[model samples]
Target: MISKNFYYQLITRVLGIVVTAIVMAFFFLKEYNALGIVVAIALIIQTSLLIQFTNNTNRKIAHFFNSIKNEDFTLRFPENLDIKSLRELNSSLNMLNSMIQKVYLKNEAQEKYYQEIIKQANIGILTLNKKGHILFVNPMMENLLNYKPLNHINQLAQVSEELHRFFSNIEPFENKLFQFSNEREKVQLSIKSTSVMLNKEELLLVVAQDIHKELDKNETDSWIRLIKVLTHEIMNTITPITSISASISKFFKVGDSIKPINELTENQIKSTSKGLDVIKEQGENLMDFVQSYRTFLSVPNPDKEPISALKLLDNVRLLLESSNTNITIKTIVKPFDLEIFADEKLINQVLINLIKNAFQALENRDTGGVITLLAGINENHTKYIQVIDNGSGISEEVMSEIFIPFFTTKNKGSGIGLSLSKHIMRLHGGSIIVVSNDIETKFTLLF
Candidate 1:
């Protein structure tokens, strides 16, 4: 196939030959015709210029096609070609280049979007090939495992010996959850695996989540349910016995029926009356104790508000002060104003109970034995109030039961004060922990 430039060169050569043939004929037929010779020479010079122009244009066109072949679209072809045929070719090539560029840009954008979603996902996502080779892991997976995905994907093993055993036991396993613990941290993860077909090959997609908080909440709820069941049973037995005994005592008042029968019956009635009175009193005490339990569980969903530590301590001190001036209650509040979000009423109850216990624990100690109340914050960013006693400290055995319902060391104690106070703290999303030795026992309320 001859190019447009070749056709132009052929046409120029043909014109020059024809003009030369005419000049030669004129020279032979009519000698010394200078004008005809000059015209022939001019046509030869004009053809030479046309040939050079065609050669240059062809070179540029070759370079343009070579650039496109090399995927270099930066080379721009001439749009305004003097030759109509080549001009149409240039327009078609430019349109094709523009279409290819648009497709490349769209593919690049989609690749970037896919990677961005993987990076931003909250669920810990991981991919494992059929050969158990980890192919991909996101940032969430790295964060949950406390190991960077960039470092340990294909090389590191995700399952431990225990988890491996559990997974191997399932036959033709579909999706399954396996609990795993890390050797590096106090973290537990539930890994759920689902096999997916990608590129006509099987791969596993593992989704992991940390369930430590959920487990802790479940255990706490179980304990509360057990305690409620026991309290209900105890109340049921106590209530009926007290009521029956008290009604039986009214039989004694119907006397004078039989003389001898009346005396024996009256004596029996007196004993029953005394027994019934004891039962009734104990039942009422039991009811009050149960009421306290209800109150502990019924910690009004705290209307949490930021409160100053100093003000909270002052309120506790005012509530604890009595007419007797022997006991010295010292408040060692931090100078800086520490604020915490908590229920003021519930916190005040916890502080006051600890204060009263501290004072009571110091009953036999020397006068002015200080019951120190300290308020501060811990490193975990949780605020705390500590009540320290300088009198007779609580024994280890008693400390264990200090927060138990109806367990008290005092002579006339209901034993629900500390228990109720601890529950109140828990309801406010906090806790009360007691640590005691023979020297000093401290009750720290953490909020």
Candidate 2:
């Protein structure tokens, strides 16, 4: 509410100016004398000065609001106004401007703080609109991709189509595992997507961390475990034979007394024969274990070549045709021309091993038993050859150890098949994963 004095002052000034101007005009027209004209000029001058003086506070207030709008908050409010209401308005505006300035400074500081964190993070970060236009990209993103000035998600298509597909189909909270191949090497990236809304614009925020080193660490750990397992098994197989040989030697020496070379009893001969047989069996088992280890480590560097997926699938089908297993085998090649760059022989070996495993699973089934080799690109446009079996699937208990070397469930299983396959894929800068349930099982080789 305006103060009574403030309202009356405005009314009084306007009425005074109008009345004096009207009287000056009347005197000028009624008497054209020198005194009358002089009086009229004096009144006019007084009115102009009064108008300017009365509006002096309003002009200053307008300039104050203009300064606040422009964020130029250095304008000082008048402190010496004779009018009490004008002084109060000026004081309130000054205080309000000061508070707004503090709030603006605080907000600016917060934005800078977050920006610094995002810039220094090790993971690549991206904020994009619904059209895939990059709204903001952190420095880590440029480092990870080695693509400077990234403006749109479609730019990834020039680097890798798989990467393009990945971002386009990414959903909130989705975790995606993919590899980006550069000229020098391939980097394994694990990305997670989150949805955020800023200023009413929907955006997808993605965080990608390079996991190549992590994978190497995990692989090194697996190798260590395998070595330990090998050591344990070797000691276990040899320990029994060592004890038996020592006991047999005691029998030959007649209970610690040196006997003649030919003075052995009939029971001693039998015992010796039994012990020899056990020793030979254990020796052969150890030999077999060593041979398996040799085979496991004998994987030659893949002779890299552009191998047609269809041709590889046909070769596998022919190889499996020689087996008498009644389980049906089918081949599916999406786009028919789908191909991969890998060692043809190694990939064939992996595929054949997977098909053999499927056949074993289908052994007792009479109907609805089939193994399908599906070759296609995943949604991320990465090449994949998946072996799916509709027979009794792998149990969860057994699934976990399927890829561990020398761990097997089948009677004649050597247990290194899956492990070898995994190593081969890793050599090709890819991986293999097994997904199984009660109804179906899948082994996917991703490249």
Candidate that scores best on TM-score: 2
Kindly report which residue stretches of model 1 are placed more than 4 angstroms away from their true locations once superposed: 1-266, 379-381
**Candidate 1 RMSD to the real structure:** 20.8
For model 2, how does the per-residue alpha-carbon lDDT over 1-447 read when each residue is reduced to its tens digit?
335656776777778767766776777687755656776676677777667756776787688778877888777777577777677767777788889889978988999999999999989999888888999999988777767788998988877788788877788888978888865679889998899999888889989988997889988987887776677678878998999999888876766688786887889889889999999998998888778878888999888888888989988988895684567778999989988999998998899889988888888887667888899998998999999998778877777667889877776756789888998999899999988887889999999
lDDT of 1 by residue, 1-447 (tens): 235645675686677767676776777568666866776676677667766656766776787778766778776657797765556657766776787777867987998899789879876787766555567888988777655643434333463556445434433334555556777655566667777888898877778766775689977875785576457557755876867775664554456443344355656767776777777777787787678667766767778899998888877777776733567776776656887789898788778778888777777766866777788877887788888877667777776567766666676766778888878888788888888877778888888
Give the distance in Å from residue 285's predicted Cα in candidate 1 to where it truly belongs.
1.8
Q: Please report, as a residue range, the 10-residue window in candidate 2 with the lowest summed lDDT.
A: 1-10
Off by over 4 Å in 2: 1-224
- Per-candidate clashes come to 0, 0
- Residue 359, candidate 1: C-alpha displacement in angstroms: 1.6
